[model samples]
Target: MRLVQVAQHADDLERAAAFYSALLGSEPTAVFDPPGLLFFDLGGVRLLLDRNAPTAVHYLYVDDLAAAIERIGDRAEVIGPPHRIFTHEDSTLGPAGHDEWQAFVRDSEGNTVGLVSFRAVA
Candidate 1:
């Protein structure tokens, strides 16, 4: 299936927009100011931030790890340092692989946003 966009709920639109702007390195492609939904382009994928609702455990993989972190450094609450997650056995469709650098963040509401970088497959 083709994945177009994933919504990450937020409590504050301006706050969330500011955070995402930093993380994405640009303003949202579109923003519904009333509903507080901001849209961002992530490589080929799209990300939608919902200001009224909060989502949890949302995983986002990006090509530029450091740049992503720097963008959201001051806006979102980052958990810890970046580390690789290897041997993800939950999915059998693939073999052993490195999870690459992973970090956590809590938005205005309480949704846990997971940013990750996948190691190149061997």
Candidate 2:
């Protein structure tokens, strides 16, 4: 099955919206007034921001790793900078001779999010 929605706690709607907007580099696709929730479209899935939402660590793929790190700046907490998590030598773990790069950062609400790229481990 495919993921449809991801929920994250957001006690502060405005703050959460702003932080997510900057972090995601896009505004929410849909916002609910009654429930006071915000939805960020992650292609097929949606990031739901509300009080009853569950806390989750989500990873987003980025084409330009350096630019993404630079854009993040000092807003959220950086758990770690870009690094080669898996290299061609670690092919046994996944496919043969494939490298993966990743970095971790915490959102305003303390949910750890990872930025990843499977293209090149640079």
TM-score top scorer: 2
Cα deviation of 52 in candidate 1 (Å)?
Answer: 4.2
* TM-score of candidate 1 to 2 decimals: 0.71
Record all residue pairs in model 2 with backbone atoms less than 3 Å apart, i.e. clashing: none
Worst 10 residues of 2 by lDDT: 89-98
Please estimate how well model 1 matches the true structure, expressed as its whole-model Cα lDDT: 0.71
- In order, candidate lDDTs are 0.71, 0.78
lDDT of 1 by residue, 1-122 (tens): 99887877877777777877776667888888785777888876878878655475777766766778776766667775677666455456333454566777775556777887766545
Q: How many collisions per candidate?
A: 3, 0
Candidate closest to the true structure, highest lDDT: 2
The window of 10 residues in a row where model 1 has the poorest summed lDDT is 90-99
- Model 2, residue 40: what's the lDDT? 92
Candidate 2, residue 63: how far the Cα is off, in Å: 1.3
lDDT by residue (tens digit), candidate 2, 1-122: 88898888887777788788887799989888777788998887988988777788778888766777677677677888888786765556544565777888887777788888765344
